[model samples]
Target: MKLFFAFAIIAIALSVVYGAPADPWNEYKTKHGKKFGSTAEDAQRKKLFLAKDALIAKHNSQPKASYQLEHNEFSDMTPAELSQYLGAVKPANKTRSLESMVRLEMETRQLPDSLDYRTDSCLPGVRNQKQCGSCWAFAAITPLEFARCKKHGALRAISEQQLVDCEPYDYGCGGGWYTNAWYYLQYEAGGAAKRSLYPYTATDNTCAFSSSMIGAKISSYGDLPSFDAAYMQSVLQDYGPISVAIAVTDSFFSYASGVYTDVECDDPNAYVNHAVVVVGWGTDNGIDYWIVRNSWGTKWGSAGYILMERGVNKCKIEKYPATILSVV
Candidate 1:
């Protein structure tokens, strides 16, 4: 009995000597205690950031990583720019533990969009390597076809580059408005091709319109009407992902992991440099969010699109469907 007691005592002492209580809350509060923002908006974001460490740590054991995908444009960056360049990297890990493949990490606006989906004219699927800003072209066309799939029942795949190289009024190589591109597709002849026809090259090259026979291409859906948030949601709900944008604040850049909230309503357009897609959304921890898909590649913002502040004007809007639509 004496020998057993001694061994037990030694084990207990060693355990106490090695493992100590860790209070992430105390450290977080202490480090950020004196940190104050310039205004109310700034102060809110500050609070959200301070809580970031704890939130990420809270779920560290069960870190959900089902956000992996191919072709991340933002790659090989320095730690200093991790937050800002989130629109660039694609995470190497892909987790399937979570039932869904995506999650929203920030609050977002839940307003309605006033546009239409044209399945015949929309892009087939998501494309990549538009570092050349040809994204203006790619992003614009996919939704057009999504509209078609919604009302017309046309499931044909449309090529965004086809509009870039062929569509008039809108320059295929340069960035342009999505609405205008649709106009060109309506009255233009040489502005059409299948996804397998033109393909994508991330690089900016002159319009090399061709007549390839890889994928199916359809005619435009005549003059359409403006859209509202409900309409966008209707189309998006029926389709898959829709491309959208939100104003990212300083906290957005500084954020490392976990849920994003209490963002500064300063510019209402902080991280306006990047673009992404709206995938899915649901509520957790009493906060509303929207799932977004980013084109900056992968390894950026939670996995692709970091959650934006939804509800209220935190993300600066109350619209549904949010931004552009994507049928492909």
Candidate 2:
């Protein structure tokens, strides 16, 4: 009887030391099925849990306004671990080319107060860049897909794997630039093949992009004026989605939903680590915001989307908006 009582007490103490009876990562584990392989890994996971709990407590204690954070798979990862998973790096300047001479009629058109490309069937279904640092490829491909659909009346899934394998100038999964990917599609690949023809392996593989499978082509690609919200709106109103690279931080990864203001990672140009697509812009609770779509899958963010603070170049999104003229 005494041994039984002592065992119960020890179990309770262990529960207290480890965590509350309710495991916070239960949902994440169930969805991802990620488990620690060794004792060292287990210890790291515990440390991640503590770190995540601290972040959660800090977020919850603050008054609900601007944005909110949620504990997800990234919560268990350290900043360095997260960065390895984030593969989109700023492209080399020599490789960066944008044709500024061509006139886009959209730039001269009157823009709406708000525009969402998804509403106009310009945006395609959300994609998961699972375990691949190929966000640069995905972000670049999104605009082309939408632009092709806008012009040809048929939405086609362009292959990011084609860029991953075939783009001679850019690194495959390690990291690359949206602009570089765009240039590759325009010049090297001679327009990208459909995903069905060149499915994404999320890893570097041999280039098998066949011209016979090519379903879409890019006539030209250009960059929007830096920090110009009006020009951005006009372009989005006409061109559909645009590719953007943003400097993300510890807090940004923890983001679940809300109009993310510049309160956290205020330095948008600190490091253009992650590439995403800006489909539209609007206001939330009086806060101006840019509608950003991420490649972290539909399970993350607001159904694979986030509302970033607008007009201030939040995360350098306004600084480097790249898009292409597409046709099928």
Candidate 3:
């Protein structure tokens, strides 16, 4: 018994050093209601548990950080695996410059010191993207919804299903650009249908769009100057929400709450794999952040939203924001 105790103490010390705690099998199972089916399943579950424990430790190691991490459906996933689930695939061709697309006389306004569109009743409810890489579709359509709501005084959930299925310019569930989705909405589909009319299935299906069922129409879309938060703030105040692509990494996937600022994800040349809407911006504990609405369900972040680090363009969020012109 003395020898066993010594070994257990050593094990705990080693775990502390390595940042991976002993798997709390019972505790995890209790929290998630998860059960392993077989010996192989049990091994997989154990692996995931270790990964989760390591991530928890990593999160706790950061001192004075604004955010905290939580265990969720993605706890089991590696950064690569999480990338598969996000799927905001950008097009291979270079995107066109915003200067050529915007009308010369579009009205504009400046934001207050801080702004949150959701507070003004601009945004709708949180959405879940599921396993599809259709975050581009969700990010693209949400601003359209905001634009329509601002013009017509009624918030409507535009169909991402239409963009996911019908737009040939994009890769559908495999991946696509949010800007291409805007072009598709303006010219191809003539506008998107209501989500109630064509609910999301998280899979690519046949195009069921009809011109007669159009709920919102966008005349044009333009990009914010790359890496300009000041311009983005003005656009958000004058227009509505904007679509943005980000360099999603392991840290981003594990994010739960507070302002996220990761140097690894700050690489502008890093592949932009996930897309979301920039609905607002604010500061928390002197850490400036952009209030972004994610489509990973309300369980993922702070009610399906993330407070991303602002000013420095963490995760390259400031690089690819696009505004839409809605004709409600």
Could you say which candidate leads in TM-score? 2
RMSD of 3: 5.3
Tens-digit lDDT track of model 1 for 14-118: 879986566543444465453335577445544554455444445344545312122111222223343333221111231211112122223244534222221
Per-residue lDDT tens digits of candidate 2, residues 1-328?
Answer: 9999999999999988996677655655676676888879877887887788797778867896578877777777766678755677775663345532244555366656677766667578889887778889899889888888878887888898998898876678888888887777777777789899899888999988789989788888777777888888887776678888888877777677888874545653477788899999988788888899888888777888899999988877787787775554
Model 2 compared with the native: what TM-score? 0.88
Give candidate 2's whole-model lDDT: 0.79
Candidate 3 or 1, higher lDDT: 3
Q: Note the clash tally of each candidate.
A: 49, 0, 0
Q: Which ten residues in a row have the lowest lDDT in candidate 1?
A: 88-97
The sequence of per-residue lDDT tens digits that candidate 3 reaches over residues 5-66 is: 99999999998889685447666677767776798877786787687778777876779767
Between candidates 1 and 3, the TM-score winner:
3
Total clashes for model 2: 0
Highest lDDT: give the candidate number: 3
Q: CA lDDT of 213 in candidate 1?
A: 37
Model 2 regions lying over 4 Å from their true place: 1-20, 25-28, 94-96, 99-110
